[model samples]
Target: MELKVLYFGMIAEVTGCNEEIILLEPNSNVDQLENLLKDKYQNLQHLSFKVAIDKEISANDTLLNPNNEIALLPPFSGG
Candidate 1:
């Protein structure tokens, strides 16, 4: 399956793009995707970020769908 991944903040800096397409197994989960990304972008392994699917924060084990919107978001703080 091909998934479109959006990158934000420092994550975008690490990826060198705001978004990109990633190919994964049909039944791949967030954890698998994370591993693939970390392998592709070594800097990501040293960063702390959250994976959001379709605008919602997803768990590591969450199943990913073909049409789901995936995003890598860096940590943030607000007053």
Candidate 2:
């Protein structure tokens, strides 16, 4: 399945782009996506971030769909 991945804050800086299309196998989960991303962008392995699926914070084992809105978000502090 083809997924659109969005990079935010420090994650975007590391990726050097705000968003991109990723192709994954059927029934792929968040962990699998993270592995693929870490392989493609070695620098990402050193960063701490959260994965959001369809605007909700998702767990590592969360299943991904082609139509889901996926985002990589760096840690943020609120005032």
Tens digit of lDDT per residue, candidate 2, span 13-55? Answer: 9999999999999999999999999999999999999999999
Error (Å) of candidate 2 at residue 10 is: 1.0
* Candidate 1 collision pairs: none
Local error of candidate 2 at 51, Å?
0.4
Q: What would you estimate as the lDDT of candidate 1? A: 0.96
* Residue 68, candidate 2: alpha-carbon lDDT: 98
C-alpha RMSD values across all candidates: 0.6, 0.7
Question: How well is each residue in 13-35 modelled by candidate 1, as lDDT tens digits?
Answer: 99899999999999999999999
**Which pairs clash in model 2?**
none
Per-model TM values vs. the true structure: 0.97, 0.97
Task: List per-prediction Cα lDDT, in the order shown.
Answer: 0.96, 0.97
Please list the residue runs of candidate 2 whose C-alpha ends up more than 4 Å from where it truly belongs after superposition: none
What's the residue-level lDDT of 36 in candidate 2?
99
